[model samples]
Target: MELFTLSLPAAIYIFVMAYIPMFGVVVAFKNYKYDKGILGSEWVGFKNFEFLFKSETAFRITRNTVLYNIGYMALTTICALAVAILLNEIAKKWLKIYQTAMILPFFLSWVVMSYITLAFLDHQSGFMNGWLSAFGFEKIKWYFEPEYWPFILNAVHLWKAIGFSALVYYAGILGIDGELYEAARIDGAKRFQLVKHITLPQLTPLIVILLILSIGNMFRGDFGLHFFIPNNSGMIYPTTDIIDTYIYRALSEVGDISMASAVGLYQSFVGFVLVIAANFTVRKINEENSLF
Candidate 1:
């Protein structure tokens, strides 16, 4: 009874915020009308989804979304692991300062960071241009160039997200049994060897779980990062455009609620499949590590 009482608030929140909105997924199949309301709207089966798949830029946006996320997930995982290990190795005297510095970026809003990025990348009167002028190099329009954006976008994402991820891994490292490390040290294991054998093995389960969950979001790009950071330049669409941003654009411009819902539904479905596949692979490799 006490446990149920303690969980009631979270149960209510999940029911209200998550379960209730699930009904709106039907909007993906409906030719919705404001006057008719959600239930009263006519059903169009898969027409909205079909419209999404048939669009000319659909392939491009999908490719960008998947590739960018895969790359981001891989890079951030490696970097976060490295950061966590380094944090764990640091003397207690300096741990807090390093942690605070690392986590500051995670708290910053994308809107604020967009302006911060503009300070350096702006073509005219920007920091990059000012430096280039002193060296006799032409000022490049950073936002107008699509090719440079892949690296830029990945760097931006890692800067904003690595902090929280590393923090999680750092906590996981803390939870590990200290006796194991003591025993390893008694055996004359070096620092690198201890990390390679002890730390990495202990972290594998957490790594697998986080990696599977990340795979689930492979289709859902961060809208604010893609939209605000690039300033939504048309020329950079080939590199920066993603399903989330594309849906935002369609809904904002055409007010096509059904199409937007369709794309969202597609994102959710693909995410679900990826999660299942990743979990199954992990299960095959080590049943103990699988999310199931």
Candidate 2:
């Protein structure tokens, strides 16, 4: 009874926020009209989906979404693990300061981050250009160049996101039994060896669960990061354009709500399949580590 009472608010929240919104999914199939309303709108079956798949930018957006997500997941996991391990090794006196500094970026909004990026990347008066000039190099138009965005986006993402991920891993590290480390030390195990054998093995299940959850979002990209960071430059669309941003443009520019909804539905379906497949593969490899 106590547990149920404690969870009641969360249950209500989920029902309202997550489940209730599912009814709008029917909009994906309907040629949604303001006057006719959702139920009264004409059913177009798969027409919206067809329009999405047939669009010229569809492939480019989809490819960018998937590749960027893969890169983000891999880089975030690796860096988070390294950061967590380092935090675990730090002296208690300085641990809190290091943690506060690293985790500060996680709280910053993407809007703030975009402006920070602009301050550094602006062609003429930017910090980066100033440094380049100091070194006798020509100023580069950072936003106009699509080639540089992949690296810039990844770096920015790492800076903003790694803090939260590292904190999660750090908490997991804290939960690990201290006796295991003590025993490892008694066996004359070096720091690297202890981490490789004790820390990594103990954290495997936590890592697998987080990875599975991340894989579910493989088809979705962070819209704010891709949209605001590059200032939505058309020239950079070749690399920065993603499904989320594309859907936003479709709705905003074309006002094709049905098409946008269809694309969103497709994104959700693909993400669901990826999660299931990833979990299945993990189950096959190690049943204990499987998410479900």
Candidate 3:
């Protein structure tokens, strides 16, 4: 009774804030009219979904979204783990400073990152162009070029995300028993040998769990990065466009609520299935680390 009373407020809060909004998912199937509103909107069965998949841009946007997320997840995971291991090796006195510097970028808003990125890549007055011109090379229009965006976006994602991801892994490393390392050292293991045999093995379960969670969101894109960093220049949309940005453009520019809802529903449904499937695969390989 005491526990129930203690948890009552949280239960009510979840019902009001989380579960209640699920009813809006009906909009995904309806021809949502503002005049009719959500409850009164005409039911269109699967027509909205049909339109969502039929558009040529749908394929392109879906491909870009999934591919970018996969690349981001792989790169970020590898880099973060590497950074975390390096930080763990450093002397304890300098650890806090390095961790703070690494994590500062994660707290900055994407809008702030946009301006920082512009400072470096702005074609006419930016630092990169100025340096190139000083070297007697012609200035390149950074934003206008689609080919450069893949590398640029990957670098930006890594720069902004590595700190947080590394911190998670670092915490996992710290939770490990110090006795294991001491034992390994007494067993004549060198530093690299200790990392390879002791540290990496201990961290594998946490790594697998994080990787599975990341795979679940493989279809989702970080809209702020794509939308703000490139400044939504249409020429670069070929490479930068993703489902979230596409849905935003549809709602704001085309005012197509039904189509936008359909796309969103598609993304959610696919992500749901991907998570379940990924979890199933992980459980098959290692039951202990599976999220379920």
Candidate 4:
């Protein structure tokens, strides 16, 4: 009875928030007229999906979304693991300070990050341009260029996300049996050898779970990061555009709610399939590491 009571609130919240909203998915197949409402609207079958599949910008957005997510997953994991290992070596006296500094960015809103990026990247009266002038170099227009955005976005995402991911990894490291490390040291194992043979092997299950979860988001992009950071510049769309931003533009500019919903549904479906496939592969390799 106590356990059921403990879980009751979460059950109700999930039913109200997650399950109830699922019914609106039907809006994707409907014309979604304001007057007719969701269920009352005309069913157009797969007509709305055609907007996404038929558009010339379709391939560009899809490629950007998948590539950006893949880059984020791979780079974030590597950097986070590295940072976590480094943090484990820090002295206890300064550990809290280092943790606070690193985790601060994770809590900041993307809107704030966008303005912070603007301050540095602005062509005139910007820090970067000022440095360029001092060094006798041409001032580059950061927002107008698509080529530089991939690196910029990756750096920004890392800055905001690495702290939290590192914290998770750090905790995992702390939970590791200290006896293992002591035993390795007694055997004359170097620090690198201990990490390679002991620490990494123990952390492999956690890494696999996180990776599988990240794979689930392979079809989605950070909408705010792509949209606000570039300030919605058309010139940079070739590099910065993703499915989430594309759907927003479709709804806001074109006012095609049904089409936008269809694209969103597509993203959700693909993400779901990716998660299942990833979990299945992991199960085949190591049943213990599989999310299921």
Selected candidate, larger lDDT, 2 vs 3: 2
Candidate 2, overall lDDT?
0.93
lDDT score of residue 279 within candidate 4: 96
> Which digits, one per residue and each the tens of the lDDT, describe model 2 over residues 1-292?
9999999999999999999999999999999999999999999999999876888998999899999999999999999999999999889999889889989988988999999999999988999999999999999999889999999999999999998899899999999999999998999999999999999999999999999999999998999999999999998999999989888887898898899889889989998999999999999999999999
Give one digit per residue, the lDDT tens place, for model 1 in 1-292.
Answer: 9999999999999999999999999999999999999999999999999766898999999999999999999999999999999999889999999999989999999999899889989999789889999999998999889999999899999999899999999999999999999999999999999899999999999999999999999999999999999999999999999989988988899999999998899999999999999999999999999999
Candidate 3 per-residue lDDT, tens place, 1-292, comes to 9999999999999999989988888998898989899989999988988765887898889899999998999999999999999999899999999999999999999999999999999988999999999999999898889999989999999999999999999998898899999998898999889889878889999998888888878887999999999999998989999989988987898888888777777878888899899889989988998888
The superposed Cα distance between candidate 3 and the true structure at residue 46, in angstroms, equals 1.1
TM-scores of the models, in the order given: 0.97, 0.98, 0.95, 0.98
Weakest 10 consecutive residues of candidate 3 by summed lDDT = 47-56
| Cα RMSD to the true fold for all candidates | 1.1, 0.9, 1.6, 0.9
Candidate 4, residues 89-181, lDDT tens digits: the string is 889999999999999999999999999999999999889999999999999999888999999999999999999999999999999999999
Question: After aligning candidate 3 to the native by TM-score, how far in Å is the CA of 18 from where it should be?
Answer: 2.0
- Runs in model 4 lying further than 4 Å from the true structure: none
Residue pairs in candidate 1 whose N, alpha carbon or C atoms collide under 3 angstroms: none
Enumerate residue pairs that collide in model 3.
none
